[model samples]
Target chain A: MAAARSDRAPRRPTISDVARRAGVSTGTVSRYLNGGHWVSAESSKLITRAIRETGYVANSTARQLRTGRSGTVAFVVDEAPARFFEDPNFEALVVAVGDALAARDRSMVLLLAGDAQSAARAETFLVTSGVDGAVTASAHPEHQLFERIQAAGIPLVNVGSPTGLEDRIAFVAADEREGARLMAEHLIAQGARRIAVIAGPAHSPGGTLRPDAFTAAVDASASEGAAPVVIGLRHGDYTVESGRAAARTLLAEHPEIDGIFAANDQMARGAIDALREDGRSVPEDVLVGGFDDSAFAGTEVPLLTTVRQDFGRIAEELVDALDKQIDAGVRTNVIVPVQLVVRDSTVRPGS
Target chain B: MAAARSDRAPRRPTISDVARRAGVSTGTVSRYLNGGHWVSAESSKLITRAIRETGYVANSTARQLRTGRSGTVAFVVDEAPARFFEDPNFEALVVAVGDALAARDRSMVLLLAGDAQSAARAETFLVTSGVDGAVTASAHPEHQLFERIQAAGIPLVNVGSPTGLEDRIAFVAADEREGARLMAEHLIAQGARRIAVIAGPAHSPGGTLRPDAFTAAVDASASEGAAPVVIGLRHGDYTVESGRAAARTLLAEHPEIDGIFAANDQMARGAIDALREDGRSVPEDVLVGGFDDSAFAGTEVPLLTTVRQDFGRIAEELVDALDKQIDAGVRTNVIVPVQLVVRDSTVRPGS
Candidate 1:
């Protein structure tokens, strides 16, 4: 009786928490709670159950009063280990965004919305937490929470241009296609024929964009009819160990490849190591190029010749977009430029 | 009169804005607004005037009844750009703290409290903001805001063992002195004498403890009254650029120095560049050792010999302590051990 009483005391539940618990999306829950004539009977029943379970009693008096906005901007990302933080490219991008937000006197909230549970929690929190806006930097395309967030009428600025959501939302992202073209052009100019491209995870927007751009550039280049014998287009999970494994596979399967274009720096370094193990000298026998000219790109033995994204600028643009959306209700799509950083991995000094 | 009433509808005044108008500390203004009971009548009067002038009201009834804890922890740091995000050391530490807090459904707030104004703002926010706790990671000994946070009875955790506040608070820190001793002993065993030390900012507790330990180790290793010459002690701001400057200054001051001990990996790499510039070979002419075996430590041209602090572990310890403080009301002091990583910078292949 005591447990039941404690649970039943909160009679009026918050619409957002209900949305989270129901797994029916914030929009459905909000619509039902607000009695928006559009909510289906089934959705309303689910919302009612979620509310009863959460036991979130809404203060009717406070609900009637207008609450002023909190000048906070939440930046949600996959704060999982061994991926974003360990990768310099991701770190740089985050810092850039943080810097941009700071300049605008907006407090940035970092939410590690990694798994489905965390993502759902994050979505509910954002919808109800009273932040003015949000910036979603999830590299994974299948993160469904963003759609829910958009439907809930919260202002958002996505960091990476994820597919399926591109038609509906605006995002600030690095020009991977241009970056890949630069990498391919550099390798081609260096007299590389047999080019192998190591792609990022197949699902991510960056993963597909880079490889696509590389193939398109090869098709358009003067070496016209003779496209680089695309040998062993292996994939890695954007980790050093995964890169090492991908390198091993590429080497074993396509031993004749003279040039390797890794979608990111870590894989490029791994490719270089595998080539060295196979007794092929870098920039002499097999040239290499990687994307996201991370700090490690310069530190590797042969010095990775890779594409550089202005992470700080990208972040700044993102912040600007978020701020505009939050203040003026205007969504923006920003394209950050990338360039090729020439280094020892592609060009032999003596040669 | 109706038009004037409509025009007088106010914008929310922030703590900083109140402080600027009141001519008092933000903490004083916050305390006055919160009915802290500790603030004097004069302070209250000033705060009231500022509030009235700015058309600001505490909205005390709403604040007390609603606005449940923000569920955020502010991770305050001293420097704005000392590789806080770039270096995996601090990033890992933050992640650990974030992970711990997130498990308990709390958010980690990153506060880059680099200067006096920001520090004051942080103090005021710590006290008045709905956050349950704070974790400060600055090396500044006279951090007034850190002191204020402690005074306000806010549960605090320092990342490094902060000076002056060590007794009244709990901290999770790297065993810097022990690490320094290990490095010194290893260098001594390698026959390095006339060692010049490139230390972090001398004002910092880490700076004092590390160099003191190194000196004590050298003295213990020496025969009675036969101490090796310790020359060219230079200070750095714990950045690669500062390290480069210090390395240049140290070499110019003591050309006979056989080894270089840098307080951080950035400084050690700078020392390596300085050695090469001065036509001196590392390990042969001048052995190099650094603290905090960062990723760059392994990538350094000669692979830096350094003390490796498990930053990830330290981060875990910090977050753990914060959790205890937040949940169980228990305070703990944890000192994570460090290891000596022997690399080509100090140990030649033949030697």
Candidate 2:
């Protein structure tokens, strides 16, 4: 099919051609492409039809120069290259965001600012690269690229609620605190008395909020006559290996712990592996729950009972929020809802 | 840290400021930014120092207008969005490519041209958006976007050996046939007579070359008295679900099949799951092997015995090739080597 099409390659149609075909000026065609706000409805219809008939593809670079809008958004990650690819959640979010942006005729330029030098480079790129805005999925609160982007006056939307810049920048994130609270409560309801939590890095929003909320929920549900509900706490870097190491520490420190809530599915899988190696059964010996119902969650030996963050919706909201910022200079904070998913990992076989 | 930096915002420096500071013309500054090939060494050093002192980040839109280079490369995916993310191989390649490009101070713009309409939009974007070049990871042989990109006189680097357009476009791919042959030989050496192959989509390069090579290897190793080696053949869509379905069909048709080779790690995982469900112990009742030793391969219960494609090196070679194309207008084809990793999945448990 590609070969057949290549046999008769015609010169690409331009905006002038579209204007000529539609019997309108090039300015009218340009106005229509930028956003037909000033153009009449009838003229817009004629231009649209002309574009279809002539296969006119507006030169975005020239349009960008004229309108000062690039129709491109940067998806920046401030983690190491390996970590960025290792996390399934990141992949899901990227794909979702890419799809959402593509639907709006916008391109997603990936920027990985792993270290201080890279951050500086990325900041420079963000400022000068003609990208209209940026959506950051970086977990590090200390990442200074955001400050530089803000200084450059680039509209921004963060995937997770950025810690220091929460109030300043637009963001779309899952309800991390509420989701963790529900998971803690669910574990309690499943008859777990001594529950432990494997938290993410303290610097990250999800890392801090999830553990804090879980601790609060567990403490609030404690009965006056009952023993303490919490047993141990361990911090992980939101990876399977870290989760395993944390789980090992938790088991060694507090053998009486009956439940574990991992910050994410990767950690939960790691914790499960640790438990299995230590001769403990899932849900039977210790109830294990995770966050982020990613693709791997369902395929686990004991399917993960996790908190589902709607990544697709979050991506749509991020693009929508970024679009609003670009068009109207509005900064909106959007927190998408989360859901609890019970699976074999948390529920006992007979129960 | 971000908060601290936001207190004192400095004005971003421009090319004119760099030129004034360096005591050079704006044209000299532009030449330095665009590779410094024609600039004097003394002038280049002064421009570099001036850029550092003034923190001048060239406005890429204006720079693009002057140089006809966008400083952005489109990473086009012709497959569905979900498949692009679900496969760990794709993630590894993307991360590697992104890192390589980042090292060269280039941004990777992701373009998902999944279906016909999306492909058309992507083609238009590529033609009109002023992207410097494109790197396609599309497996589809008939993807029209490649032809459009070619017609637009844009440099392209395909991740895999795209069928039909292999000679026209530059590509960096693993030696798929050699890798498959090695896996086939490994399985045969493990005393597996009744081997079965779960192939990828027939249209893809890996889909055709891998199975063909495996068949050739098995046939070459066949003895005069030997009846038949391959007892069953099933095609998969390079996905876990497809692998599981295909494995079921293969098992049901040839219950005596003692070996299974899946085209990729995801499908190998699904094949393992299917074998476990059917009460077939790996390497004991039925040996299983996979290609692309991805992140999931190592984490599997019986660590996968697979063919490892060095995606990092492939990515480096891709960027290197693309860089050459951008600078010297040279198109090069790179075929990286693959290795067979032996693990418990293919070898007997005691062995």
Candidate 3:
């Protein structure tokens, strides 16, 4: 049977054949094949000529099948339909991931699995849909989609750090703890004495780690003899409405609060709206900070001071981790860095 | 050969068998198989039990292959990556389309073919990727993606009316001309005289038809012996920044303009921003109107006065049209209705 299968294989040109014909290294040919961004012009021309001469078709599907892959990947977002539409961060990440996958000559199938029925449908699709691997983003910790995919022994990469299943699955994430620390420190440096937080959903990775890290940083920054004062801590579901509601609660309970740190940018915008309604001016009255400098961050009247997570880099890392796991049976955990973007919302006016 | 093919057919229970066992119509069985949303609870239970007893599985891929179908559909968006991310309308349509396809047990593969090279890649993928059919949204009239897909003889359903190709392909669109006329008439009825328009991209269907329809409506409403007075007409790329720039131009050229109609909501928001910057109050000094009552419309402070397209219905129609083309070689052109949503932006404060 093995001999028969070997004999039935088609006479397709491999990467080595193209490289040999072009008088270049296989690595150079590979780079050219995966979007010739790094390949020299002369090298690219030579490689193209060689590929044409050899009648080499980059049949990714055939290649993937030979190695027990389906040549397709699922980009599963685990948010409810409404929430998925509301969040710009999710859209940015998905776009970046799609571009990354396209450059590698692979197709992306989008699956939104929020509830039990959808999760079951997603599980069934992943298991029998002929997709070789999967990448999940913005999944709530309680969602069973990831567990189901993992249980089926599918090679998968989680976009954020999975809480309980971290050690078991590969993941790529922005350092939420560090991002929160940066936001908290910036607010304190802006002379905010009483800081309140609009924490994200409790079951999400960002929802948990961001608030914890912010509180920890606040406590650590206190004076030697000064006791840490907990003003207000409210949880939100990462929607603008939720953010506004949380801000209202904080305003009523901790009227003296002068700084607000929202886990994400949407919540930050909502907080700004609430402050404006209550006759408070941002940066002048209360310094505001947000995470994930999304599209809305810059469009607001006073630009948001937030942590900029490199979604493009994070997407690249996700595709790379999933590719490695699929090709070599190895797992990877990648944490892309975040940068603080200071804008009018956090800076003291006229300073 | 025919006898041998018939002999080799798989021994699987068919839809008719399930219908007979469940004591229901074949249509009922089919509806239950396709999400069962409209099916009665008792009927659904009966169908489920019948399917289980007969070991019936709705293996779409296998069924499609037997009839030369691919069982997959491509949802192509011909917009730049940044614009795709910024527009909430595209996101909503995609989400709704995904849901519609999921109900029918089909998978959706996303293709963002913005430029020429990517369009070529998309063309190749669609022609050879084994997608049974395709649905394209927000494509420019000059884009080659649609032409290439058409040339390749792939069944396609366009989201909006294709200007010159309307008679050649199936489409599902909200009546852009009618929607524009409604907005214009509403603005005039609100007692605005000098009106300006921020038109969409010139090469798109909405870009051309919306402005034309608005102008026609304005001319039709004019008093006898009074030629239509054109105040300001400029083009935008359907973005907030473009809207702001266009509004600035209008303010400079026609400062007395009291009514502004933007082709879409993002631009409408930008126009509102510019008006505010110039110390002009909305609906008091100038009435601002937008198109596509997007998520931002209701969230804006004054609330956007815009046309609301039933995106959910449009998505369903697109899928249904494509499905018909694939199943029985039939094509459909559906135009859904749009409603005018009046808000504070277009209403006088104390009216």
Instruction: Give the number of colliding residue pairs in candidate 2.
Output: 0
Candidates sorted on DockQ, descending: 2, 3, 1
Per-residue lDDT of model 2, residues B229-278, tens digit only: 87778889888988999999899998989899998888888888899899
The CAPRI category of model 2 is: incorrect
lDDT for each residue of candidate 3 in A1-351, tens digit (9 for 90 to 100): 433532222334566777889999989876665434477757866776665455444433334645444445778888666677678888898789878977776666677777655665565445433466889877665557776677545689998887767898799989988998888878887788788999987667667888999889888886444344447899998888889999999999989989999998889889999999999999899999999999869887789999999999999999899988888879999999999999999898676
Provide the lDDT at A328 for model 1: 66
Give TM-scores of chain A for all candidates: 0.77, 0.82, 0.81
- Per-residue alpha-carbon lDDT of model 2 for A186-248, expressed as tens digits? 888887888888998876765788888988998988644455377888899989999999999
Query: How many clashes in each structure?
Result: 1, 0, 0
Which is the leading candidate under DockQ? 2
Chain A of model 2 scored by TM-score: 0.82
lDDT, residue A71, model 2: 60
Clashing pairs in 2: none
Native contacts kept, each candidate: 0.03, 0.16, 0.06
Find the 10 residues in a row with the least total lDDT in model 3 chain B. B2-11
Q: How close to the true structure is residue A236 of candidate 1, measured as C-alpha lDDT?
A: 86
